[model samples]
Target chain A: MSSNLILLVSLLAGLLLGFFTKPAANRARLANRLLMATILVLIFMMGARLGLMPDLGERILAYGRAAIVITISALIFSIIAVRILVWLFMRKRGGEL
Target chain B: MMLLAIISCLLLGLGAAYIGLMPPEVAVFVNEAPFYCLCAMLFIVGYGMGQDKNTLRGLFKENAFVFLVPVGTIIGTLVGGLLAGLILPLGIRESMAVAGGFGWYTYSAVYLAEMHSADLGAIAFLSNVSREMLAIILIPAVVRFFGAYPAVSICGATSMDVTLPLLAHYAGSKIGAAAFLHGAVLSFVTPLLLPLLIGF
Candidate 1:
């Protein structure tokens, strides 16, 4: 199966299981802890993979710069758009200021 | 602290690889590890969402219009991605795909790596991680100054989890609820968007 399909399937399976089982709070917390550890391991593996890439230094530098640029732009634009939404919302509510 | 730990983990792995600490036999496992991790993470996230029972249902019920915030976030972030694409070396689609991550770094990184270039995937990871870190830092100030919507908007998908408490404490429970709704919607949609956009 495709990766995305795998993701969706796993997610739906988990959702169904959790919904039916209604695991205790402690179990949920343990699940969360396990998730965090898994995430860290994933990141570590990503780093290792990147490290093994050719021209590792240059790639990191370039990717880092692009990352910063993309992040800042996304943040600014999302804020602006939401601000407009807020303004429109207030106006639609008959200017309840 | 979580951010620091994530970074530390990344660095540690990089350092380990840099020094050839892992045997060649282990490289295969390390390479395949992210896919499993992504699946595990998604399952856990889905389970959490299932357990909550409120976020998806609440979106349609109370304050239904709050859904617009996420709409705004999606459009604005895509626009930003387009502009960034123009400014940067990446293609417009590539840039938008990266932006479509919406601060969910883990999935974005792994998905992009498998579907697209590993480099692009790495960029998605770094960019989304930075986005989350920036949101965490800016949220309180944004709430106090710009108001609640902007504060929540800054968090992207993370408003549902990583930054929800901060939004609640600073912006109040009402905005907190909106933030959760915003995040839940975004989280559901981002995976769909990333693949569609990155196809180019």
Candidate 2:
């Protein structure tokens, strides 16, 4: 099966399971534990996979200047854009400044 | 919680690889296992969303204003990228391809490498990696100063995965769902935009 289909099926299965389960505090706690465990494993695996890639030290050193500039700029612009939207939203609501 | 775990594991794995502790066969598993793990994570995300009525309701109840997060993020990243490009020796197309990763470094870097230069690919990888690290550190500050939506938007594609749990925790399920949506949209476009923009 296709990866997309696999992703969709997994999501749908989870949704169905969640929909049917009773919303007890214990159940929520279990789910939280399960989520945390899965995330830990997933991230660990992600790190391992990333580690298999080419020399990161050289990559960082080679591209550090461009990378830093680009990343910081993208971050700044994204924040500024959201800040502007928030201001516009507040203005529409006649929020007290 | 996540920072310590993620950083430790990442360093441990890299250290292990560097020291030649792991076998070559481990490389095969490393390539495929992450994909399965990602699917499981997505499933968990779906389950959480399914259980949360408020998240579902917020997703459906949104109007045109709701689009601001995704739209603003894309415009902001591209604008920032274009401006940042002015400083680089690289062309605008190359810069966009690098920034277009939107924090999904592996896919965009590989794609760019195949379609463009190894240098551009390396730049894309480093750019996206730095973006993720910065986003993790910045999300809380963004939440405190700007608000939840802004916090989520700045992280881009990472909002769907690496940053999702944090977003859900600090920002609540409502913003988590929005961040997921925003990330999904960006993730879908990163590949398309990288090549298309570069072609121009």
Candidate 3:
């Protein structure tokens, strides 16, 4: 099977399990523990990759610029969009103030 | 399920990165950053679901007007992005920046950088990721302090995922559902608009 197919199957299986599990027990906690373990392993692998970088300074600069522009734009857009949305919808709903 | 999803994504990302199908850096990002993020997100989502399953049902029934909120958010986001492009001193790459702002920040930045030789891939990544993060943090505040509409607007493309829960939590599930719908509708629209506005 293709990796995509395998991934999809896994996802479906997980969803089914999550769906069937009663919310009362510590099932969620168990799932969280599993997720945490996965994350730690992934993080270690990522750090290894980062350590392979030859020029950390240049990479940081490049990534930094990208990060700054994206961050600012995202922040500005989010704030403004939320505000405008509230203004238009709230009034229509006859919301006070 | 969420854990499995994260693992699957990690594996896919790792394979893609290792195979040189995508930038190694991106693979690293997928591995390092999203693991913690997704873990926290999954736990929170599960906890929230456990705590408020009943409240969610009740809220949906109570506030039908909440449906209008997400519509406002989408419109607001589009306008905000356009305005940012116009006002910001982003130079020739402003369109790319706008595309990033529209929420395909990683793809937008990387594509534009490669095409234009602008080397702004990091900026694109940060811009888009920041939008997602900001939406996560601000959606609830925006909903409670301003209103649901504004909160959704601020979320941009993240309304479907990161901001959806917060919207449901604060604005009511009806509004959250509306936000998801609005986000879905906007996702397709964003791809088309990103290219037009950013020239990529």
Candidate 4:
């Protein structure tokens, strides 16, 4: 299945469970702890993936110039676009949100 | 504390793997591990959504604005990268394709590798990875100054997973559904548009 599909299914399952359970405070806190543990494993795996990739040093040396420029530019412009779009959206809605 | 754990785990994982301390089976496990973790994360995300009707209501009322987030991200990312391209040796389309990853490095980098060259692929990988890191670090500041919507957009595809916890913490539950939808739409469109853009 697509990663997207997996995401939706998992989310739906969680929703059903959450809605049905009406989790108590302790249960909710436990869920948060579990989520944190999951997040740590995920981050570690991401790092492992990065570590396993080939030619990191060479690639960085070669692409470092363009990578830095493109990364920064993409962040700036995407933020700008979202800002402008949200601004226009709020204006159309008739006030600040 | 959460951020510290994330960064440290990442560093620790990198160190162990780089030093060949991670067992070979552990390498195989890594491939499958994150996918499952992602599923759990999304599940919790959904649970949070279900737990709050107000948040869902807010997302529904802002449906039009929700539509705009991805639109802005696409236009903004492309325009930003294209402008940045002026200084680099890459073609305009190449720049767009690279930034088009929206912090999804693996697929875009692989696609660019096949469509263009390994060099462009490497660039895509590096830039997208850097983009994710930057978004993760700056999201709180972005939300504080610019508002949550833009902060979410800065996360791009990562809003769905890696950077998601940040979105929830800083943006509050009201912004949850919208950010998830925004990330989902971008994640869907990226693979389709990126290759097409590279061809153009």
DockQ of 4: 0.44
Which regions of candidate 2 deviate over 4 angstroms? A1-60, A94-97, B1-58
lDDT for position B94 in model 3: 57
> Per-prediction TM-score, please?
0.92, 0.63, 0.51, 0.63
Question: Over the stretch A37-62, how does candidate 1's per-residue lDDT look in tens digits?
Answer: 98898888877877777778888899
lDDT of 4 by residue, B5-71 (tens): 7668767876788778889999988766665676677677557546654544566666667878889
Higher-TM-score candidate among 3 and 4? 4
Going through the candidates in order, their DockQ values are: 0.65, 0.39, 0.20, 0.44
RMSD of each: 2.1, 5.9, 9.1, 6.2
Residues B117-187 of candidate 2 have per-residue lDDT tens digits of 55676677678878888888887877877778778877888897789888777777667667777886686
Give Cα distance to truth, residue B103, candidate 1, Å.
0.9
lDDT (C-alpha, whole model) for all candidates: 0.84, 0.70, 0.50, 0.75
Model 2 C-alpha RMSD to native? 5.9
Q: CA lDDT of B83 in candidate 4? A: 86
Query: Best-fitting candidate, measured by TM-score?
Result: 1
